[model samples]
Target: MLSMVRRPNPVQWLRYAAGGRLPDHLREWVLRDVTTRTWFLRGAARSSLLVLPLSSVWLLLPGPLGLRLSLCLMALLVGYFYSLAYLEESCEHKLVKHGYRYGSGRATRNAAKDALEAEAHARYVARYRN
Candidate 1:
């Protein structure tokens, strides 16, 4: 099923990062993106593209090289910390932009997690409660 879903090309992804929408054909791919196991990592990577350029400007400030580098690292860390704080909301917004309901992305992820927990409990019951 996933094999049939087409990924966005680099240009399309850049547009996506800039808040543009993809075509409807990529809707399933969008859902998978927001619900996958690596969704948090993917969100961090996406946010880094926006954060990196801004942080890099600190390197151009007039100062000792070590001081400039330290400021750049501080800015990068702060940017990433804020990005992580809102990561789930950011992913949900992506799903909403892709035409899904507001909370559907989180719902889908929770459903997958619940299924795994249920399967684990079933295995425990079968082994110990029989």
Candidate 2:
């Protein structure tokens, strides 16, 4: 639940604060944990930062309706997925900064560690291994 939000670095805290205003109680909770910031990117604030160029497409594609449509669709998808990727990536820095991860990447380090440890187990039966 809370893992959905990774604490941000001290320097990046400004980015979170700049996005929008939070209620006093909520703000207190966030400030309570300097380890990570709420990744709750507000509606337009975060999405506005998306790198889509639909305006350029309209300007450049003066003809070919199908091509333009396809390009527009592609741009929408690219921007959508790119923004999601950015959000996940933005949270990833917490793994190194705090020795813990949050958001979608949370437990990834633990999972990897578990996998590595499993590989070293010496009590498993041959049939179980297979």
Give the clashing residue pairs of candidate 1, or none.
Answer: none
Scored by CA lDDT, what does every candidate get? Answer: 0.89, 0.49
The best candidate in terms of lDDT = 1
Give lDDT for model 1. Answer: 0.89
On the 0 to 100 scale, the lDDT of residue 56 in model 2 is 43
Enumerate residue pairs that collide in model 2. 7-36, 7-37, 8-36, 8-37
Candidate 2 lDDT score relative to the true structure: 0.49
Off by over 4 Å in 2: 1-45, 54-59, 92-130
Residue 11, candidate 1: C-alpha displacement in angstroms: 1.5
Q: Write the per-residue lDDT of candidate 2 for residues 27-126, one digit (tens) a residue.
A: 3334324323234343224454444444346537677887877777777777667666665554444233434434424454356557767866644644
lDDT of 1 at 3: 87
Error of 2 at 36 (Å): 10
Error of 1 at 12 (Å): 1.1
Q: Which regions of candidate 1 are displaced past 4 Å? A: none
Q: Candidate 1, after superposition: displacement of residue 61 in Å?
A: 2.0
